[model samples]
Target: MGNINKRGSKDLVVDSDQSQQDSPTITVDNQLCDAIIKEDCSTIKALLRSHPVNQPLTILTSYRLLFEQQTCTVIPIHLAAEYCKPRSLLCLLEHGADPEVRDTQGHTTLHLMLLHWPIVSSTWTKPGNRIQRLMADIQNNAVSCLHILFQHGAQVNAQVGNSNKYSPLHLAITYGTHPILSLLAQNGAQVNAVNESSMTPLHMAADILNENMIKTLIACGANVNCVIPHNGNTALKLAVCTASSKAGQLLSAGVGCIRLLLIHGAHVNAQDHEGQTALHEACCGGREAIINLLLEFEANVNILTKNGESAIYMYLQRSSNIRDLMVLTRLLYCSYPLRLTNRQGVLPAGIMLPEFQLLKETLVRLARKPLPLEDICKKNIRNIYGKKYKYYVRQLLPGKLWNSIYNCYDLADVLKGDL
Candidate 1:
């Protein structure tokens, strides 16, 4: 009986010590919590100096003492954010709390701030809801917190482990926080890093159509042609597939990037897993300027994909841009014995319904245009100036314009069949 009592006493002392150690340092939690709740600085400073490495799990528990008992282990920054104390939050971050520390639910300080600040601010009814405060925090010291995490080797490339796997850089871009993205990139974030869906920062930039971000990424040497691992879609491919403003910006940037890729020896004939080339993308985008440029680089006009669709077919099917239509016609007529069959074994002309019959007929007229007198000329001099000049004139001026000189008639009236 005496031995058992002694053993029980020792066990009780061990439990007590464990309890004391498990408790957050009371003085530190009280002082910091007071600062955070009251927006006090001196108390926060004294508390920081005393226990510079103190954590906030206890004061948060005290808040549960104030409210009902709920699991509350958020850090001081998160608490500051909760109380709408931006200045105090900044102080805590400056003092050495880990911003990237995950809560029990795995939310970081930024995530907490992003999630809760607006809610707390919204309860005030009508003073503008602390938007400027939150934006300022995010723009200034919060970005520094993000940078600090990066400096200490945090992963900007980390996805949220959801289906989307959006990285920090992806979030910054999505939120239009340009400064954060720039900081992340400067801190060695992968500009072209992909998410679980195999979408790179370039893909996000293109999807969002942030022209400045896109240009910045391109300038930073993002692989413009980096294909998504899952679908084999390039940044250019994704850009063209959308009807959003981003598509316009990418098309406006034109073949400069595309030309850069091609000049650097990007496979002009490289097909997506779907078997579409950059030319096909440009045509489908109805970007006349880019289509012209791609053709100049000799992008495969008749290159069939696994589905057997040619660039011309995609242009006719997806676009109403007159320039794309003209360029497609030129590509088809200029090719050697052009075939109209797409990847699906559907001829572009035969597949035409009422929507595209006019276009199809127009293309047929262009394809059936007569060869020039120069091709028939035997002499070198005639050959130089004859058929070539005829082709040039026909290409440069419409049939009506040429007929005004040839038939001595009113070009507009005659072309409209009025005469």
Candidate 2:
């Protein structure tokens, strides 16, 4: 009895090398791969009785693999999602396959489904009949796969990679439909989730001027004031700096985007890591409408960036504004600080186009004269509210005595008198 107790019939511990030698290899899972190709869940279930449900099997896909001639490493769930095989996916999930298992590219099953889906930028309108049919079929297939994965407990907010860290919400903005976005948001995907580049879905929305996406994101409690990583760019700044030229589609939407951003309490004067503000970006881009809206929200013309470049300096960089001079008139009306200079102590007149000698002289004269009393009071009120001045301006200052001055001050009329 003592001998049997001390020296057990079975070995006390399994050898590491022996376990490794006994484990199944890529070549050993040929049956699993064949079942995945046929989406034969019955065979998969039968096989899973003897093997692991989450075993890495080789399969042939159009993109990653081809046929009997080629193959790539993927678990059953990945193969199912990649092929939009919801039944196969559900089967694997039912058998306890991990829904969040990543592919070679670090994409989860949801990522595989999303990456292959086609997106037409004009989500509101349908295209030609042929394209529309194609889109509908694709949308159904992709959406079904997403629903199955979600039902199986796949992470809605699961990021793509360890280093890249792009959330599913970010991908949905580009490749996903409103249903996918809604599903993710409803299932607790962080609306404000930041990627490795410190970009949020709101930033992408602003870049593309997707008004619907912007409104939806903000309604879901997105931070309009959130900035990017290195450059620290806010959504409003990105909106002002929108550089898209898609048949002028995105260009005309600039005013609407800035309006939405400003109305929702985006800081008009929110500075970047380099201390540049949205007004500066608008000025640089020569965006008259955007600049006007920024000024209406009380963007400080006197705010100098880290390089000591004021809005006046930025406005002059665009050659198109030279003939118009409307920007100069607006700057004067908004009480752009007169004596503010660049890093080298250079005033606007110092680099002023010789063609506008008359305006240069006027600028010099304005610098000598004191700012108007009304302008002084307005500046003081704005300063009191600091960065959060937009709310108070709409509520308090537009009261009894100065309502006309606050709300209806004529820009052209005021500039004519000053000049």
Candidate 3:
């Protein structure tokens, strides 16, 4: 194949040795595209070098490529990235192939690299050796391609994609590319860059309950309390919402992420657009561990949503399991107000079904009997000190006094009901 020349206003022709009758003239763009699909590094290099300086290379015309019977518009670099052909990608980049060039959908080569990575799901019953090897190769090539692009002065924080305008860091977090996330952060990728949905990389990590990614983002200076612009939902809110449907391994990881966020100063009582806090979301999830964690952080159980629904009210409406009932019991012991009414004028106690007769009776009794004065004082003290009270108390008090307060068995005993 030789240089591309305009045969007519509408057609591009590639000069070749074969006669026109023997091998009909093919479009020059098609010739280069075929080389890209086949990963012909030598052919690509020849075409780039021998192409006329005045004409320049219109490689963008060959954006569309067929993969697994699906047609997607992709530049040569993106195609190379997808196929894990690092040699071809580097050759194209050296030849002026823009690493920042976006496809029709505004996705850069970096976005395609993360998007096409082979994700091995837990549900796969049997992954053959070929599949495993293929996955490993893909991962290796992806890392190499990323490094090459960065070295070539690719914008680390360039937001691509038509829908969300996601930065490379966002894609890394979304695709579970742990190493890539770290690389991007270390290379000056904006840790707090919000996507089209106002979600930062931290929000994405928290949404998936990825503890390691969360830690990485936080260490890179992610704002722990940064709320999504539209929903005003923080990373803590996203974590609680995600933990609801997760189970077993994912649930444990979710719990850990929440704990990590809280320890890093995530506000427990931060409300969303509807005035619902992390406690409200946890209650809606009906997970005992999450609810207990938020309660221990002193999430105001009596806090109301825009609709006047409290956390306990939402819990009652969403969950009916015995475990959830026990969670409600714990909330009651924590002094969640029993007399709160929602916007619809429905009280939490009045809506209790007959199956929860014991709970209903207990709530009635608690409503009539005043909480212990000492317990009320302790609750107030905790509220004043905030969740990091223990650390402050330790720093302010002597070891013996601190131990005495820390080992307050009566406080623990009162919180733990005999039932």
Task: Find the candidate with the highest TM-score and give its number.
Answer: 2
As for TM-score, the candidate ahead, 1 or 3, is: 3
What 10-residue stretch in candidate 3 is worst by lDDT? 1-10
User: What is the TM-score of candidate 1?
Assistant: 0.59
Any runs in candidate 2 off by more than 4 Å, and if so which?
1-40, 43-52, 60-69, 120-131, 243-250, 348-351, 371-419
Query: Which of the predicted structures, 1 or 3, would earn the higher lDDT when compared with the native?
Result: 3
Expressed as tens digits, the lDDT of each residue in 1-419 for candidate 2 is: 00111111111122233434443653345566557646788888888887687877643323213222334556777766665666677888888888888876788888767765545445436545665766555556667878887777889888998686889988878765555667778778899998888899999888877777888888888999998879989998887788323322344667787789889999888899888988887777665666777877778877888988888777765545544356666565455465446788776543366665655566667667787787777656544443345456566554664443444346444444433
Per-candidate count of clashing residue pairs (backbone under 3 Å): 5, 1, 0
Q: Give, for candidate 1, the lowest lDDT window spanning 10 residues.
A: 1-10
lDDT of 2 at 174: 73
Each candidate's lDDT (Cα)? 0.54, 0.68, 0.68
lDDT for predicted candidate 3 compared with the true structure: 0.68
RMSD of each: 13.0, 12.3, 8.1
Estimate, for each residue in 1-419, the C-alpha lDDT of model 3 and write its tens digit: 11122111112222333222232222344456567656788888776665431232343222123211212233567667666677778888888877777776777777777766545444445545676655655656667877888888788888886788899888888764566777888888999998999999999999888888899888889999999988899999999888875462353648889899999999999999999999888877677788878877768887889999887777766434333345655555445355445788775643366655555555457666776776565555545553447678678878875564344454335434422
